[model samples]
Target: MSDHTINLNKAHFTISAPDIRKLPNDDGIEVAFAGRSNAGKSSALNTLTRQKSLARTSKTPGRTQLINVFEVEEGMRLVDLPGYGFAKVPLEMKKKWQKALGEYLEKRESLQGLVVLMDIRHPLKDLDHQLIEWAVESELPVLALLTKADKLSQGKASAQVLDVKKKLKPLGGDIKVYGFSSLKRTGFDQATQVISQWFSQNIENTEESDEVAE
Candidate 1:
């Protein structure tokens, strides 16, 4: 396949659907970003896209209660999934968000990859593990970002990345782990390249299948 690169910086808001049913048609390639509340997911997304307000970082956790969509190009999109594990929210609201997240993961046919962000200091909570396991089971590629790496010393952050990798190695899926910091721009290139490659690979695969059908 050619070295096709996706310009994530060109991403623009498409829709903020309350649930999967309200999203755009399940076509093209979508890479979803998911994480616990307060994981700096919005910051990471803004850094990746070079757009300050694209994903809407909020001072309060659980502010993002919808499935946010941004289109990088015609057939390439980035999704900011609802944050999980925010205890301050009401139980019913939490359940609603969880239901939407679960439905999207299980049913979205255009979902080609998952980007699971976690605070580097507190990596991989129970919900994080569950999400990763589900993606692995579904045969979806995952790019696990250990966000807020700048909060830790380089040596400590590197060690944490290794530890997380060691733990996840047994899952035996296409999962890549990296220490990422939206503030420091740590792992920015690596993260962008991985996500871009996902889109590029999906396009190439679809093209090949179409050629075969001809």
Candidate 2:
């Protein structure tokens, strides 16, 4: 789909709900962005939508402590899940977040896919693997972005992309890993295309199910 078609530029914050029960009704397709704290998830969301403050970028890790929802269009939502794995977070609080995240990923009916972000220099940390595993178990599609690609040389970034892809093979779900730089806006189109495809696929599936029922 063309960039004009998604109209992500029109995207705007809908709400920030601390709990899943408080999120907008699970009536339509949505994609969740998940990553370790400080992995550039907010920066990526902002870049993809072409809205600087659509998702808040903070110098402090784990600043986004709630589930943030943005409207991509009617019935289409982009969810920014709270980042995990900040060192200063209490173990008890971290466990709560983890449980909540796992439940959200596994049980949220409207969640169509996930965008997993990882720092280019620190790809596939323990929590990152856990997130990917959750997606795999849920049978959700994933687009893994190696964020901060601009910090590395072109050759190094390309190699990291390949290495990340290779490492992800073991988890084995519908996953596509790409080198992405929020600063340079590199891989913006490609990342958005994957998200757009997830929306399209969900629509198609819903239609097919309706036809079968009829």
Candidate 3:
């Protein structure tokens, strides 16, 4: 069976602090969403899953401060990670967030793919490049979503897509991107397809026993 066919449901929540002894267990292929704060990360998540409050939307950036894990189905998890690039937070807290998030992204073995959300009007910024670099360095495939496409005119959106493409080519091959608007329910199918393909292929590759053995 494919991920598209898999029945997705809510799983659980977690808040990992610097002193926290451990993060959640990475047992299955976990697809994560990461973006800068207030970049429509939560909205896009709600849009993709057809759940209004599946992820909490915040007017302020950096509100999601946890390694929130939602089990998409029996064999996979959808991880909503804390957004990056919120510098107004305290310096000490920033350091802790960086350490915690960076460690999770780097060390999580079941993390199969990353869905990087970028605001359509403001794509390819410094923070975006940094996270893209992290995904590439980890050898993880990224599916870039240019959210809030409704804000831009069609012509402008087309141009922005090209611009993002130019920036992503250097990261690695096979990166997928789409113009999405959570409010208007646009691009849901495309994003769902991306997740479906990612999880399905990953589930096929390594067995559960093999993962445990490793």
Candidate 4:
């Protein structure tokens, strides 16, 4: 039961590890962001942290090949996983990135939440569905962000969000769907609130565990 607040704006770059072995000691709460190559994951991250270039946006869709870590504070981190479902990359290279992503997702003890970004116009691709399903199966909370929402009209965007929600409703897990626009800050408040709550909930859980041990 601590009163401290989580501030994503204070996030700072820590490391970009090619593999999970190179990541910091797995002792803290980490919320990971995962998406397709053209899903605007970097832009969404930059918006979340209120930094112009915090996550390194690129003209090339699959440029982010490593697992980038940022620290919001000690024991609280945000991870940017390698983009998936990019058709332009070499088959061998794509396999490697997928391997890294799978390893991180399966083995990372600190992962508390997952933020899955997909283009509003073309969401829930095969890989995206697989990732979200896996997260739900693992009982992990998820925030499904339909990125580039500004590209669509308000009515269309709202319809898209509802459609996604309806499709994922059967999973029966802790999942949320929202339309997000990094360029216009759409869903920014809801996104931040959900992510902050995840961190806070993890902190409370850790505290309870410590008390029980004592």
Error of 3 at 176 (Å): 0.8
- Name every residue pair that clashes in candidate 1: none
Off by over 4 Å in 2: 1-4
Q: Name the candidate, 2 or 4, with the larger TM-score value.
A: 4
- Cα lDDT for residue 86, candidate 2: 89
Q: Residue-wise lDDT of candidate 2 within 142-199, one digit each (tens)?
A: 9999999999999999999999888889888899999999899888989989998887
Worst 10 residues of 1 by lDDT: 1-10
User: lDDT per residue, candidate 1, 1-214, as tens digits?
Assistant: 6577789999999999999999999999999999999999999999999999998988998999999999999989999999999999999999999999999999999999999999999998999999999999999999999999999999999999999999998888999999999999999999999999999999999989999999
Q: Assess every candidate by TM-score.
A: 0.98, 0.93, 0.87, 0.99
Best candidate according to lDDT: 4
Q: Ranking by TM-score, best first?
A: 4, 1, 2, 3
Most accurate candidate by TM-score: 4
Q: Where does candidate 1 stray beyond 4 Å?
A: none
Q: How would you encode candidate 3's per-residue C-alpha lDDT over 1-214 as one tens digit per residue?
A: 3334544434434433342235556577888898888689988888787787888887788887776767776658888877878877887777777676787787788888899999998887797888878888878888889999999998898788888988788777568888889977667888888887888787767655466788
Q: How many clashes does each candidate structure show, in the order listed?
A: 0, 0, 0, 0
User: Can you write out model 4's per-residue Cα lDDT over 78-120, one digit (the tens) per residue?
Assistant: 9999999999999999999999999999999999999999999
Which candidate, 1 or 4, has the higher lDDT? 4
Please report, in order, the local distance difference test score of every candidate based on alpha carbons: 0.96, 0.88, 0.78, 0.97
Q: Could you tell me the lDDT of residue 133 within candidate 1?
A: 90
